[model samples]
Target: MDNYSVKKLSKLAGVSVRTLHLYDKMGLLKPSVRTEARYRLYGEKELLRLQQILFYRELDFPLKEIGAILDDPAFDIVQALEGHKKALLARRERINTLVGTIEKTLVTLKNNTMLQVEDLYEGISPEKVQAWRTEAMAKWGKETVLEAEENLRSFSKEEMDGLKTELNDNITARLTALMHTDPKGPEVQELIARRYQIILRLTGGQIKMEKLEYFRKLGELYVEDNRYTPVNGMPSMELALFIKEATDHYVSEQKK
Candidate 1:
């Protein structure tokens, strides 16, 4: 029968001899035979076992868990291989997204432009993006969501950065400063108007009739979604709700 010594198996498997020794010590993998000279040798069965071990390792399985899984009497090689294939495909998909994001970033840098918010989230799954769009459409209508997306995509990187800075630094900072004040006070109302203006700037003044309602919904999102709550290094649910209340009052007054 063909066999490989520790050194040979290490070279063939691309695993370190020390790692193989450690596996042996842990009783995770054992040599098929020990030569008279006290050298460990692995036969075909051991090689196949090592391949399984490597596959599990690639999936980030703990060595103990891998050993337990492999040692399970009900374990099926075909099922395990199918699971590995599924995991590898998912990983490849994420890698492809990251690669695309990198390419876009490179182009943006070459053109001296800024990246869009969606660009920052390029590595997120498309399913998640679709889910967000679906939720927004349900609340704000499809036309509003599509228009917002189009408006966001139309901006250059520098323009997006300026808008983001205004929202983060100016609006958020001012809102946080008024957290203890009345949500419907004149000062807070003015800041809410400024917030609406920033959104209009982001949408290039195309918000028109949807401006008040859009800002109101955005404020609700800031309060409801932790993803949108944090700004300028402050992550406070209370602060977000306060902004939502202020925008709600502003929208109500504007309607009269």
Candidate 2:
């Protein structure tokens, strides 16, 4: 194993020697060996451990918790990294939502218009909203689910029914007809754009249709959700896969 002096390891790990010394005292990190003069030296394993420490710190994990996690006999580096990746992704998604909310709030401020709470969930029924709330609460706990959202107590049932009618009567029909068309073709892309607009309308500006990743993820949802994928699937999954393909192509083209 390659060994590094405390100073060299500190430089390589981008940590101060004092910090490394502190970690050693806390039993969070121990050097691989000691020199004849009692100087500290680290090995490759110590270097990797220091990296894990930094990663946890970046994610706001407390030093004590980070130390415990790294010292756990059951700890697996890959699993820890995967947890970090998931937490980061969730954080990014929250940031995007906040940014979108800020943009809408800015527009409301500029126009001197009030943003009604009901408008945040336009064209969605109380029943559906409640269903969503139930699912969220089950997964993330009631307080966590409700603390960040406006109380979704009521909504116009008629608006939700109208949107459902439009989806069943108009949108799905149009998508079905275009199933055989090239997803990248002008006609299909146009239809996809129209569908996006309709979603924006129904959402009352809550959904950021402008995000290419959002649309791409929605396409993935259609393929993964059995409600959308009714047939063989992929290019042959009929209207469901057609919408997925068309929306994906639409996003790709928009990037150019």
- What overall lDDT goes with each candidate model? 0.66, 0.59
The digit string of per-residue lDDT tens for model 1 on 69-104 reads 788878675776688779789999999999999988
Tens-place lDDT per residue, model 2, 93-131, is: 999999999987775563332124333344566686567
RMSD of each: 18.6, 20.7
Q: Runs in model 2 with CA error above 4 Å? A: 1-3, 33-39, 55-66, 76-86, 112-256
Considering only N, C-alpha and C atoms within 3 Å, which residue pairs clash in candidate 2?
A: none
Candidate 2: residue 103 Cα off by (Å): 1.2
For residue 109, what is the lDDT in candidate 2? 64
RMSD of 2: 20.7
TM-score of 2: 0.34
